[model samples]
Each structure stands twice: as C-alpha cells, then as structure tokens.
Target: LGVRNLIQGLGEALPFADDTFDRVTMGYALRHVADLHALFAEYRRVLKPGGEVLLLEITRPERALPRALLKFYMKGVVPAVTRLFRHSSEAQELMRYYWDTIEQCVPPSTILAAMAEAGLHQAQRRIVLGIFSEYCGAEAGTDR
Candidate 1:
C-alpha cells in the first residue's frame, strides 16, 4: 500500500478538476453521504468521459429471516460481544450506528437511477451473498 497523493475531500463536492480521473470508487460509505445526486454528479464531473464509477456497500438483506438475523447480530450480538471484551461504549454505539445506516440506506434501484440521472450510462448493481452490493456505472462517451 505505497499509495501517494491521497487528498481528503467531501464526496458531494469533490476537490478535483473536471474529467480528471478514469474511475471513481466508494466503499461502504454511501449511507453516510448527504445526497446521492450530488455525490454522483461530483463523481461524473471528475471522471473522464467513458470512465467508470464503482460503489461497494453492505445493503440490508431483502428476505425477512436474513434481515432479522443481521439486525440481531449487528444490534445485539455485536454490542454484547464488544462489551464482554471490555470495549468502550463508543465502540458499541458505533456498531449499532453501522447497522442503523444499513437498515436506512436507499434502495439499490434508487442508487442506479441516481447514477443514470447524473449522466452515467449502463448503471447497474450486483448483489453478493444477499447483502453486499456492487454498483457500477460509466461515463456517457469516450470522446468529450
């Protein structure tokens, strides 16, 4: 991981020049964003035409059983285990918050639509293990 040139910036207002990158990616942060439209617009603006965007997120399961199990694990078992291990209250709260965000995150369809509305093409989502979502979209054209 000898990466360099890491610049910290907001997702909705990326601090980059137009068409500067070939791809943009976000991992497990979609639920925390203030606005999907603005975030995707920023991604589109920073990407070179034909560039791609990828978002990796943990979505709540659609099935009731799996959803309930996940909720129990995240909200109950995780916090209980952390407390058993003598972790701080902040850590326990953080686990609950993580579950809350996933429970309240926008649907995959809405995310794809936002990508399309931001001018990206071929917007789609791939679900893994019934919970992990990989969202992908591409810039409209190869030529500016």
Candidate 2:
C-alpha cells in the first residue's frame, strides 16, 4: 500500500477542542516529541472523561542480546534505509535523530510514570516484536 491521508501536525499540540474525542491513536509517535508529558496532557484534555488513547511504540527489550541487536540495527541499518528514501545525507541525519525507531532514550518506568502523571487511570505497556511496545491508556474519572 502507498502512503495515504498524510497530515501535517505539531507533535506537542493538537487542534481538536477539549473533551470532544472518544479515542486518540498514535503509532510510534510520542517519543520523538520534544515534550512527551505535554503531549500526554493534551491527550487527556481532548479526550472525554472515559475516553482512551492507544499508542504503538518500540521499547528497549529487557534481555541483553535483544537490546544490543536492536540498538545496532537502529544505528547501522536505519541510516541506509533513510538514504534509500530521502537520498540526502542531511535528511538522513534528521531521520536518524527523530525517526530512527529506537527505544533507548527513555526507560519503561518513565513512560508509566508519565501516564500516571497525565491523569490516566489505567496505563499498560506491552512489548511486541520482542523490541517494540503497545501502550494503551484510559482517562482517570470513569471506566471505558
């Protein structure tokens, strides 16, 4: 499939009115933002009292070998992929910094704490692909 429904958006701010949406979905979109906490705050603000947000994310694996392999793959192979698509070294560098898809910058616990601080009632982190994560969260006031 080709890319479709491409959107221009600010990572830290969304355009929707508060408490309007039932759910917000993100695929590997939170970590690269300059302030993830603020983004979560916005998610909380826009969602209804019982609404939820589902996020697809990559996380550093707990095991040693898998973690090492993921880091190596991200650092070594990702740049090549960026070149294949972007065809520019500067773009590649930007991609490497913001879109490299590695999970090393922040730890798992920090993510959980952020959800809690963002007023999310129940937040869960599940790792898939042995190197990525799926996070689902709910608003604090009501069950959804």
Candidate 3:
C-alpha cells in the first residue's frame, strides 16, 4: 500500500501492519539482503491474502553460449570499464568478485521455494534473459 509513500521512518523491519499489503516488490534488492529467507518471511508476514510478490533480478546465464559470453563480459569488458573509473585493477577485481559470488552463491529455486515455504500460494519464475529472471508469487489462499 505504501509503495509510493517514500516514508523514511520504516526500518528494514517494515512499519506496516500485518496482512495489509497487496503487492510486495523488491526490484533487484536481493543483491544486498544478507539473509534471503528472512526477507521472504517478512514479505509473507506483511502481504495480505492473495497478495503477490514480485522480484526482478539478475541471474547467471544457464545456457552455454550465453554463459560463455557472460564470462567474457565479466572477465574482460567489465574490468576494462572499471579500470577507467578508478585506475585500480583491484576495484575491477572486486567488482568481478561480487558478480562471481552472486553467480556461485544464489540459486533461483532456493528463492522460489523460500516463498512457498513462507506460504505464498502460487510461486513461479519467468526468465527475462539468459542472465536475468523475474520471480512472481502470490500469498496462500489467493486466487490466480
């Protein structure tokens, strides 16, 4: 309900009442949340019956060709660009490490199953690209 409110008072712990929200959107915020399941649980707690959760995210490519391209970009192009930013190869390496860890660490199914465990009724995923996906789900007892 407060998607556009822009209120500064709410903490990482949301201020809204339980079961008050209809749509929970975390657009690419997954990169920062340390405990993924806790975030999903909080979303589950706040969303009303039939409420939906939408997550837009960047994922490692699953296809071989795309994966190879991504490796090239990650290992080559991104580092080249980063060098322009700070004249620091370590910065580029750090940035590369970030994406590398993201690819090695996060799992799409783990995320979806966490939603299901949180009582989201219908959880599904749509791959937007070889390197990205959108996870959409609804609260338990909700109609499609």
Candidate 4:
C-alpha cells in the first residue's frame, strides 16, 4: 500500500486541471451528490483520454424478496454486529445511512446515462446480488 499523492477534493468542484489523472474512482458517495451529471462530467474533465472511472455503490434490488432481505441485513444484522465490534453507535448510524441511501438512490440506468452524457463511452454496470454495483466508464474517443 505504498500509494503516493492521496489527495482529497470536492467532487462537484474538483481542484485539478484538465486530464490530470489516468483514472478516478468514487465509492458509495454518488447518492450524496446533488448533481449526478455534473459529478460525472467533473470526473471526465480530470481524467486523461482513455482513462476510466469506477463507481462503487449500493443499489436497490429489482425483486421484493431480495430487497426485503437486504434491508433486514443492513438495518438489523449489520448494525447489531457493528455494535459488538465498536462501542460507538456512529457505526450503526452509518449503516442506517448507507441503507437509506441505497433505498432512495436513482436507478442504475440513470447513472449510466449521466456517464454517457458526460462524454464517457462503454459505460456499464455490474450488479451483485441485485445490491452491490460497480459502474465503469471510459472516456470517449479512447481506444482503451
């Protein structure tokens, strides 16, 4: 884990010049963004041609049973287990927030469209258990 230049910046208004990085990744924060389109566009602007953007998010399942099961696991089991490992209730609150965001987040199609509109091509979403999702996109005009 010898990573250099670990920097933090606002998603909506990235403090970087054009084509600065080869790749960008957003994890579990897309739901918190006010404008998905704008955030995607910003990601594109900072990425070099052929660069990739990866987004990791929790998504709502299509089926009712999976949804109910996920809710039970996240809201009930996860928090309860977290309470055992950590003394603070903040972990439980964080889990609740994650579940709420996943429950209320926009559809995966919308996110893909935003990536495409932001000049990213080959955008695709891989969903696991109808819950965890990995959204990946490459910059347009790239042979990658």
Candidate 5:
C-alpha cells in the first residue's frame, strides 16, 4: 500500500517516459476524462510492450428499473445519508456529481473502440452486477 512514486498527472498526457511501466491502472475515473482516445494513447505510450491496462468504472445500467434504482441510491440515498452523519454539503454534492457523471458517460462500446483505436490489442470490457465495468487491453507485442 506504500506507493512512494505516485505522481499526479493528466491521463491524456502522462508524465512518464515511453515504455516506463509494465502496467497501467485506473479506478472509477474514466467518466472524468476529457478524451478517451488521448487517455488510452497516453496509457499505451507509457506501458511496456505487451503490458496490460485495466480500468475500473461504474457504468450506468442499461435497463430503466436498474438505472432508476442506482440513481436513487447514488444521487438520493447516499447524499441524504452523508448529510445525516457528517452534515457536509460538499459530501452530498460530490455524490450527486458522481451520479451525474455516470449517467452522462459514454457507452461501453465507445470506450472499447477508443482503446482499440489507440493501438491497444484485445480491448474488451467485463461487466459485473450490470453496473461495474472492467476494461482491459494489452500493448501490442509479446511480453518482455
């Protein structure tokens, strides 16, 4: 858990040398990226040949019932609960923003296509619980 070399930088323009990392990972931040193509290109640039990329995202459910339920939980229940315990408007607003992003995010097909367009091989998404999406791809080469 002690990640000493963590550097805060933009996903579209990574602050690292080419082929510097064997793997790249992001969690619950895909919806915040301004450009999926640029982000995936940067990821590919930094990864060693055959290196893998994994992104964890909360995708909005496709069906109306599940989407409504998720929206109720994230946008309503979470904020309400946060206000009850913490009395912080910021926390409540953050949850609302989270739901908004998920609601407005592009579909899984578009994301996968972006990855493939960025030259990542075998791009695919795995869904869990109809809401959690795990996007994965590998740099185009044999493992070094």
Candidate 6:
C-alpha cells in the first residue's frame, strides 16, 4: 500500500502525461462524472498500451425487486447507519446524493459504448448481486 504519487486531479483533464500508468481505476465515482466519454478519454490517454481500466459503480438494476432492495439500502439503511454511527449529517447527505445519482445515471450499455468509443476494446460489464457493476476494459496492446 505504498503509493508514492497520488495527485489530486480531475478525471476530465488528468494531470499525468500520456501512457503514464498501466492501470486506472475509478470506484463508485462514475455516477458523479459529468461526462463519461471525457473521463474515459483521459483514462485511455494516461494508460500504457494494453493497460487495464476498472470501474466499480452502483448501477441501476433492470428488475423491480433488486432495484427496490437497492433503493431501500441506499435511501434508508445507509443514511440511518451513517447518522447513528458517524453522527454526521454531511455523511448522510453524501450517501443520499450517491443514491440520487445512481437512480438517475445512464444504463450500463451506454457506459460500455462510451468506453469503446474511447478506444477501450473488450469492454465488459460484470454485475454483482444485480446492482454492483464492475466494468472492465483495456487499451490495444502493441501485439494487436
């Protein structure tokens, strides 16, 4: 866990040079990105050839039961836990904000398309428990 360089930078305009990294990961922040394509572009730009990209996000499930359960957890349980343990209104508000964004976010297909358009081939979405989405893709390697 020794990360030497962790720069605070925007996803749309990453501060690193081209091909600076071999792997790029965005966790639970896809819903907050204003432009998915631009963010993916920056990710691709900074990644070395054949570099991996992993996006862990809260996706809206298609079915009724799963969606309902997710909503209940996000809107009800998360805030309650935060309010009780953390005793922070701001943390509760942040969780509420996360739920709102996930509720309104674009579908997984659209996000996959954006990754493809950004030159990330082999884009795939692996959903867990019907709600958690793990999006994985990679840049074309020199062998390709």
lDDT, candidate 2, 73-124, per-residue tens: 6666877888998899996686567434465446777877887788876888
Kindly list the per-residue Cα lDDT of model 4 for residues 1-144, writing each as its tens digit.
898888787897899998888899988888888898889889988899888999999888989998999899989999999999996699889988878988889899999999999888899999876788999999874532
Best by TM-score: 5
lDDT of 6 by residue, 62-132 (tens): 88988898899999999999999999999999898878898997899999999999989899999888788
User: Which residue runs of candidate 1 sit more than 4 Å off their true CA positions?
Assistant: 142-144
RMSD, candidate 5, Å: 2.1
Question: Pairs clashing in candidate 3?
Answer: none
Candidate 3: C-alpha lDDT? 0.77
Provide the overall lDDT of each model, using Cα atoms, as 2-decimal numbers: 0.92, 0.76, 0.77, 0.88, 0.93, 0.90
Note the clash tally of each candidate: 0, 0, 0, 0, 0, 0
lDDT of 5 by residue, 61-114 (tens): 999999999999999999999999989999989989989999998899999999
Q: Model 6, poorest ten-residue lDDT window?
A: 135-144
Could you tell me the C-alpha RMSD of candidate 2 in Å? 4.1
> Which stretch of 10 consecutive residues in model 3 shows the poorest summed lDDT?
4-13
Give the local distance difference test score of model 4: 0.88
- Residue-wise lDDT of candidate 3 within 1-144, one digit each (tens)? 658756552224777788889898977657666677777777877888878999888887777888888888887888889999889978988878867765674678888887788677678889876667799988874432
Q: Candidate 1, residue 93: CA error in Å?
A: 1.2
For candidate 1, the clash count comes to: 0
- Model 3: how far is 35 from its true place, Å? 3.1
TM-score of each: 0.92, 0.73, 0.75, 0.88, 0.94, 0.88
TM-score of 3: 0.75
lDDT of 6: 0.90
Q: How accurate is candidate 5 locally (lDDT)?
A: 0.93
List all candidate RMSDs to the true structure. Answer: 1.6, 4.1, 4.2, 2.6, 2.1, 2.2
Give lDDT: candidate 3, residue 11: 21
Q: How do the candidates rank by lDDT, highest first? A: 5, 1, 6, 4, 3, 2
Off by over 4 Å in 5: 142-144
